[model samples]
Target: MGESGAYRRLPVAERRRQLLVAALDLFSHRPPEQVSIDDIASAAGASRPLVYRYFPGGRQQIYEAALRSAAEQLTACFTEPPAGTPTQRLRNALDRYLAFVADHDAGFSALVRGGCVTETSRTTAIIDEVRRAAAEQVFVHLGVPAPGLMLRMAVRSWIAAVETVSLIWLDEGRQPPADQLRDWLIDHFVAVLTATAAGDPQSSEVLSGFLAAVEGQPRSVR
Candidate 1:
């Protein structure tokens, strides 16, 4: 279709969606610093002015839209309870996360590694929400207090660990495959939780230290 005809035909919502999707794809391969309005326009099959018409705030707005999309996909599986034990729930969560990453690798990569988000308030809020949700889930699974200080610590550590492992996997082109990594994560969590429940002081202490270290940090998200 001609540019003017295409622009006239696309609804505002459709145009915004297209811009967000294309911007995310571009941001994944490079940081926001390297991305431009023209790149997003070409990628989205829309005119340059059309892209800006939908995203007047430019790159930052596009970055936020990308983040929202990434968050939606990643958090979808955790919205419901699994059909088994706590260990099963954790396994299921891991499976969902890996699948999301695999399917939306570009978006996930942009959000986590491409350095689009910069504002402290926005970044912290996003991280806090993700960490709180994760911690609450783990606490519920373990029959622990959800809002307790320990839960906060646990959540922070969990987020940090997940992000760290995710980056390593992404850099290595996800060596050993997502299924292998998912299984390994499940086994590790089960072992550690079992040890903690069995009153292993070393396990408790190690976990506590890890949690504390993450919680003490100011910015948990990047």
Candidate 2:
């Protein structure tokens, strides 16, 4: 048997998954423009044509798919089981997010900064959706079913801060450890919410509930 005959065949779904995994791996380390169809094909142990068969739009399509996958994972980072204080819960979510940023430093940078040659309206929308979803999850954690304008703005601003700091963390070679960064971000969120609570009745209520949760926790936990 020849070398090609030594390989086993993968089902269509499995083949597609493999190709996506390879593409995502490349995208995680380098910008989309630097990656090629042959790179993905070679990384997946397949031919270039097979990649084309899976993604007809070529590199752009593959980049989009990878971006979508990354966005899903990033959004999921904010999804913690409703069990901790608001601060603890946000910390948990930030833990997951920071881990992802550390794992996919290059791709996270590209996704947040957004000047890639392959970027499109669709990709921009996907990024925006991730931010919206994160802010919404944060609101849910704060026990606010319907947040007011100030409350909503505070949450969105915290999300933006997380993105900006994550990018800076990557640039700084992830110094001061992920835990320090996570704690700093949580403190930032608390500061923002506390300041907003001073003038907005809606925000004040939410802040009270959040603080109650934090206060109920053991000192060690805090």
Candidate 3:
């Protein structure tokens, strides 16, 4: 917190963390582009030089840090599953997902916009990982093998669907109707799994193939 001729007292990690906290607060009030390093440094109660020392690249660094913070918070929501059926678990995930967006309204909005601007944008990889993990959870819970191209496509598609739904809701400036979203997901899940569970051999076959793709196996779509 103090400084001398050539060195400051705060550790590098702590300074970066403080910078991110400051950036997140600023982002909540306005878009990322509207914010400046001075704003962040001012909010952080640190000198501009000190802020630069922690994040020399400036805005981009702060933006990425803000995103990382959001991702970490969202991931924390999924850390545990309460006692419930598969449907309950899916509902719980959706509930938590929406709650996360609502809780960090500004930061989540910025992340969505920032990520779309470039494929190389910050948080893309983190989002991808989150989606993949969610998909895996869905398939695995249904007792599917989750292998191959179908697996890949299914999980990716599923995750995209969920994210897209959430994004649309956010864009509309409405919290995704949690009950409605949960019911919809549950219905889609039941349709597939129930068909497979029934004696419908074709549905079972298709599901098995999809699950295989999810498990990293290759499958011909045709």
Using TM-score as the measure, the top candidate is 2
Instruction: Give the clash count for model 3.
Output: 18
| TM-score of every model versus the real structure | 0.74, 0.93, 0.70
Q: What TM-score would candidate 2 get against the native? A: 0.93
Query: Sort by TM-score, best first: what order?
Result: 2, 1, 3
Counting clashing residue pairs in each candidate, in order, gives: 0, 0, 18
Residue 91 alpha-carbon offset, candidate 3, angstroms: 1.7
Model 1 misplacement above 4 A: 103-110, 113-120, 140-147, 194-222
Ordered from best to worst lDDT, the candidate numbers read 2, 3, 1
TM-score of 3: 0.70
| RMSD, one per candidate, in order | 8.4, 3.2, 7.2
Residue 186 in model 3: shift from native, Å? 2.9
Query: RMSD to the native, candidate 2?
Result: 3.2
Expressed as tens digits, the lDDT of each residue in 14-113 for candidate 3 is 7778778888878765667778888988898887888777778777776776777777777666554434444555677777887776666665666665
Candidate 1 lDDT over residue span 65-113, tens digit each: 7766766655665654634444456667887877766665554665565
lDDT of each: 0.63, 0.85, 0.64
